[model samples]
Target: MAVIATLADVRDTDPVDLTPLQSTVDPEELDSLVRVRNGANGDTHVTFTHEGHAITVHSYGMVAITPEHELTAEKYERGEGR
Candidate 1:
């Protein structure tokens, strides 16, 4: 997954690059994880922590990211993270 794409959807500002996620999981791995979760659960979602933010990627092509401080965990878990 492209963190920049997901971040762009959830955040107000546009990120020029994913440099901030350099220490996080590889983008390819993230993409692979989403693919696996989608395949295993048939369009389900999988979430993980990245840079202190909770990131959820759904098989329906929705990516929701909320920081811990925002306390949007319930919304994200309900697939309403947007």
Candidate 2:
């Protein structure tokens, strides 16, 4: 089977717990986002800023979180986010 890694997994952060982001984003909305994008077509994602961090959650079961400013620089350097 295929293995999907999340933002926490990539960043080596805490486990997959959206409790902290609950205050910033509605849990139900987040759940809906994930549910709707679970298995669709092309790259589908939602971006939001939470606690000064830019967060992008993808459809295939992964989230990318990075500092607002640094995110641009990093993505540029890596030729990502094109």
Candidate 3:
């Protein structure tokens, strides 16, 4: 829900316009994994791309979404885009 809402907000479009997060990643598994990591006070993080955006969902309740261009820039900045 959060991921969809965020991606939609960032893209300035309705949630229905975006691909469902379930197609990219298993929500229930992700939640369970993050929940356990959070319970243990660990720094759990997961990153994936959806709808041309790079998304990082942190166990601490932070969701960072980077658009395709920014992601390309970041990868090139680190000399990995090529």
Candidate 4:
């Protein structure tokens, strides 16, 4: 069976948890590294790494994942129409 790990679980690992969001990247594609930082009022900075390339995303309360790119907090909030 596959194991699902959360940010809190990997906190002390070589890679740290900087966000509360989960990883959805395909393992077959590349090994991934992620970081998340809790921000003001549920805001957070989420970063993902594949190979040596990294992408940062800002999200509030929740995060949206996709195959191509991660969206920023501004974009996420806007999508919510809040």
Candidate 5:
């Protein structure tokens, strides 16, 4: 919800009319990942492009977004882009 809200704000649009977050990320997996990473004290985040921006959700309940860019080549080369 936070991610969606933030994206909507960044894009200056309504949340309900935006494409579903589930289209870009699995809600259950995201919740589980954040919970487990926080429990383990890991510096965890999940990043994906949504609504023309890069959305990164952190384990500390922070949502970050930026304009779309090519950000996966290096990570993919190192096999960590997933």
Candidate 6:
């Protein structure tokens, strides 16, 4: 099963800091492949991958390592991730 990890969860588990990766990517590009929401704490964000696309989720954020299988924007809108 695919797992979801929050920023806090990542910090607790991983020893290496991921500030560099977070700074490199555009937040808009990240949003293109996944949905990010402000966590309850308001300091961190929770990222959810596009369904069926098992993305490699790092500590800073989520990335679509593999190309997404053909799916229309309408289909994506029907579901949660867009």
Q: Global lDDT of each model?
A: 0.66, 0.61, 0.85, 0.36, 0.81, 0.40
Candidate 4 lDDT by residue in tens digits, 16-81: 433322354543332222223345446544556532224344443233223233334556667853
User: Residue pairs in steric clash, candidate 6?
Assistant: none
Query: For model 4, what is the alpha-carbon lDDT of residue 1?
Result: 5
Whose TM-score is greatest here? 3
Best-to-worst lDDT order: 3, 5, 1, 2, 6, 4
Better of 1 and 4 by lDDT: 1
- Compared with the true structure, what per-residue lDDT tens digits does model 2 show for residues 4-65? 13444544555444336666777567766665443446567778876556777766766777
Clashes of each: 1, 0, 0, 4, 0, 0
* TM-score of each predicted structure versus truth: 0.55, 0.54, 0.82, 0.22, 0.73, 0.24
lDDT of 4 at 30: 22
The TM-score measured for candidate 5 stands at: 0.73
Model 1 misplacement above 4 A = 17-19, 36-41, 72-82
Candidate 5 lDDT over residue span 1-82, tens digit each: 7888998998899999899999988988988776535455766888888877888888888888887654556567788876
Full-model lDDT, candidate 2: 0.61
Q: Please give the TM-score that candidate 1 achieves against the real structure.
A: 0.55
Model 1 gets an lDDT of 0.66
| Candidate 1: Cα lDDT at 18 | 41
For residue 13, what is the lDDT in candidate 1? 57
Report how far residue 45 has shifted in candidate 3, in Å: 0.9
Q: If both were scored by lDDT, which would come out higher, candidate 4 or candidate 6?
A: 6
Q: List the residue pairs that clash in candidate 5.
A: none
